[model samples]
Target: MSPFLINLALNFLFGSKGKEVIDLAQRLILAAENAGGSGEEKFRAVMTALSQYAQEHGLLANFPQPLREAIFRLVIEALVFLLSKQGLINTHKRAYYEQPTFPWA
Candidate 1:
């Protein structure tokens, strides 16, 4: 299973109030895959979805900074894992190292 799917499953199984977020991420992942973009583009799409979810749901504001950071980290890691599984990323590199360079960058 891709990391995104795994995280979604685990969140559904163990995370309290994570169903919506997981479902959103899953949908975004599927969309990115179907869009047939480059690996980097697909990864960016997933990250963008996650960022949008966090902002829309006020996850960043509702949770403490540490908790918010942790959650974001988990989601990014899951995305990288999923992308890598799809042969989009080189698994040898650290996922955290590949930061997106947007205006938010």
Candidate 2:
């Protein structure tokens, strides 16, 4: 994702009504970390946690399915970008996201 898109997603996530989304992302990251396998396994763990979270939390329930999915994707991508920048997690996609511009700054 580009910095612009990442910034947009971050704006939404860090906004007033962002707690739920942020919590979901944090939980997913934790799930990935605890997956205990290759990068692919960690990715699967995040997706599995996402499913469970959706069932439990009804995340973005009021939104249409497509919009909700798009939001989820954006949230995950932006978060992974940020965390990887901080040397938190390595999904092997960091090289692609390294840019001179820092969206979270």
Candidate 3:
């Protein structure tokens, strides 16, 4: 749901790093969860991961540009793919797509 942060992280994942960004993000998210944090906490963890990676890659200079949104959106696609691998989101204990079934329909 918080594409903003994920997309930002995605921007840091270009070139050779692109192939491993999802795995890195998943690891950060899982680690955050294992520490008893919520999904929002996981999101923040991945954002921090991306920021740190970008810093290592010297990609931080490009982040302040206004023209980067399109690139960010592109990264969002990969982030979505990574998040999907987590299977069902556990919040509220009900399936996100679950709807009331009409037995007599």
Tell me the TM-score of each prediction against the true structure.
0.46, 0.56, 0.42
What lDDT tens digits, residue by residue, belong to model 3 across residues 31-55?
5566566656655565555556556
Candidate number of the best TM-score: 2
- Output the lDDT of residue 95, model 3: 42
User: Compared with the true structure, what per-residue lDDT tens digits does model 1 show for residues 1-105?
Assistant: 666876687677768657665587577767577667687787667667766777887767767867866776687776666566566666565444445535475
Q: Which residue ranges in model 3 land beyond 4 Å of their true spot?
A: 1-35, 65-77, 82-105
RMSD of each: 8.5, 7.6, 10.5
Relative to the true structure, candidate 1 reaches a TM of: 0.46
Model 1 scores what on Cα lDDT? 0.67
1 against 3, candidate with superior lDDT: 1
lDDT of 2 by residue, 11-95 (tens): 7767754556667777997898899989789877887788678869676678887786676667677777777886766557677
* lDDT, model 2: 0.74
TM-score of 2: 0.56
lDDT of the candidates, in the order given: 0.67, 0.74, 0.54
Model 2 misplaced regions, further than 4 Å: 1-14, 60-74, 90-93, 99-105
Clashing pairs in 1: none
Residue 45's C-alpha lDDT in candidate 1? 72
List of clashing residue pairs for candidate 2: none
Per-residue lDDT, model 1, residue 5, is 75
